[model samples]
Every structure is written in structure tokens, then in C-alpha cells.
Target: ERFRQVIWPGNSTTVPKGWEIPTNGKKLIVGVPMKKGFFDFVEVKRRSINNAETILSGYSIDVFEAALKKLPYSVIPKYVYLKSPVNYD
Candidate 1:
């Protein structure tokens, strides 16, 4: 998701007059804090993808699902990742 710097009392392009509003470059810009490498969600997602790959090596999700099914529903996987339709030939 993109962060917007919509102006108050006006459209997103312009702010209201006589308003002592301060932006501090935070509303428009994307980041967590301290100007670290994670200045946006994309960087965070990329890091998570890399980390998951390392932890999930030699592990199959199907096996995990089978084990989960043997357990109670409360202990089963929550919010499973499902495939979505994509444009293809």
C-alpha cells in the first residue's frame, strides 16, 4: 500500500492556507523509524520471504497440513495461504 499526503481542507495536491501544518516528511514518505533499511513495506516483505525460505527448507507444507488435520481444529493452521487466479496463456 502507498502512503498519501493528502492535504487538509483541500485536495491531495494542495493544503489549506493559513494552516500551520507540519509534515516532517512522514505522512508522504514510507518507513518505520530512525531511517533504517526498512523504509517501506516492500522491503519488509522481501526480508520475510528470504527468512521464511531459510526456515522452511526441507519442510513440506502438505505434511504440516496433514499433521494439523489430525489435531483439533483450534490447533490447526489458521489463515491458510491459498492460490489466486492470475492471467495466463
Candidate 2:
């Protein structure tokens, strides 16, 4: 027999009998824009010695992290630094 569980936000903390919690191992890739104007929103910096080392921070990242905490399932976010001076056109 297959069992399913439904978790409502702020409803209850107890798990129902015979219900199994779902697990996801896949990671979600998130792109952060590299802009020169607004450093408060998002900022991406690479080390001079090792280009592979990236440092990400700012207000936008904080907001995104807060939203992720509200989700019922766990999500792993892989941040990718986008090219600077991005043009939509």
C-alpha cells in the first residue's frame, strides 16, 4: 500500500500515521546578475587568485533565502554567476 502525506503551512507539526515524507536530492540552479550600479540588490565577486571562488551577497540574496525557508520541501540552490553588463536585447 502506498501512503501520502500533506503538510499545510502553520497547520500542524505532527505527521499522520502511515504517511511518508518526500525527499528530493536534485538541486535548483539560480542565476545572479552581475551589475555595477546596484550593489545592494545583488553582487558577485571572484577572487583574483582563483577565478573559481565566487562570493555572493546583498539584499536580494537575503530575500531569496527567507522565501526558501517557508517551503515544505528542502531545496538545494546552486548559485551561478552571470556575465556582467547583461543585455536583455
Candidate 3:
């Protein structure tokens, strides 16, 4: 079901002549920004179980992960914790 071409980093020739090489990396870095307020839009929560494992779950996170899975090729994203929401300006 994978309809996209898989090209590793530093190996651009694997891409088709007319196709553009996608981002290079086995795991992509995804930043999840959350506001300080407890809104439902983008709220990030971290849970620790006996200090063994850390788990992140929220409405925004679930949507982001689901979108990634729909891609034709494999894309594993490593979530980066942002202390505060991102400011584009």
C-alpha cells in the first residue's frame, strides 16, 4: 500500500527524475506546541508511571500521529517538548 518512493538521507539519486526528494531522516523531529492555558485545542500532558516510562496524550497529539500514518511512505516522528507555544512573529 506504499505508493511513495523511499529515499534515504544523502542519497538523492533514488528519487525519480521529476520528483523532489523528501526530507532526509529516518525519524523526523515534530514539535508539539501547547499554550499555558488548559484549552482543548492544543493541550499537552505528560504522565510518568513509576518514573519508568513517559507518555504524552492529547487531542492534538492524536490527530498529528494519525495524519502521519496516512502518508504513503514510512515516517517516524520524534516528538520534541516545547515549554511554551510557538510564536511565529
Clashes of each: 0, 0, 0
Name the lDDT of candidate 3. Answer: 0.65
Alpha-carbon lDDT of model 2: 0.74
- In candidate 3, what are the lDDT values of residues 1-89, reduced to their tens digit? 77766776677647444223355655778876655764564665556655445466667778888997777666677877676746745
Which residues of candidate 2, in runs, are more than 4 Å off? 1-24
Least lDDT summed over 10 consecutive residues: which range in candidate 3?
13-22
Query: Is candidate 1 or 2 superior in TM-score?
Result: 2
Best by TM-score: 2
Using lDDT as the measure, which candidate wins? 2
- Show model 3 residue runs off by greater than 4 Å: 1-25, 49-52
TM-score of each: 0.19, 0.64, 0.54
Candidate 1 per-residue lDDT over residues 1-89, each given as its tens digit = 99977766535566535313433322222212222232232112223644453111113444554675564332423222222324222
Give the candidates in order of lDDT, highest first.
2, 3, 1
- Candidate 1: count the clashes: 0
lDDT of 2 at 46: 87
Tens digit of per-residue lDDT, candidate 2, span 1-89: 98666665557557634213335555779988776878888888887686878888889999999897777656678987677745855
Using TM-score, rank the candidates from best to worst: 2, 3, 1
Q: Candidates' lDDT values, in order?
A: 0.35, 0.74, 0.65
Candidate 3 lDDT for residue 34: 53
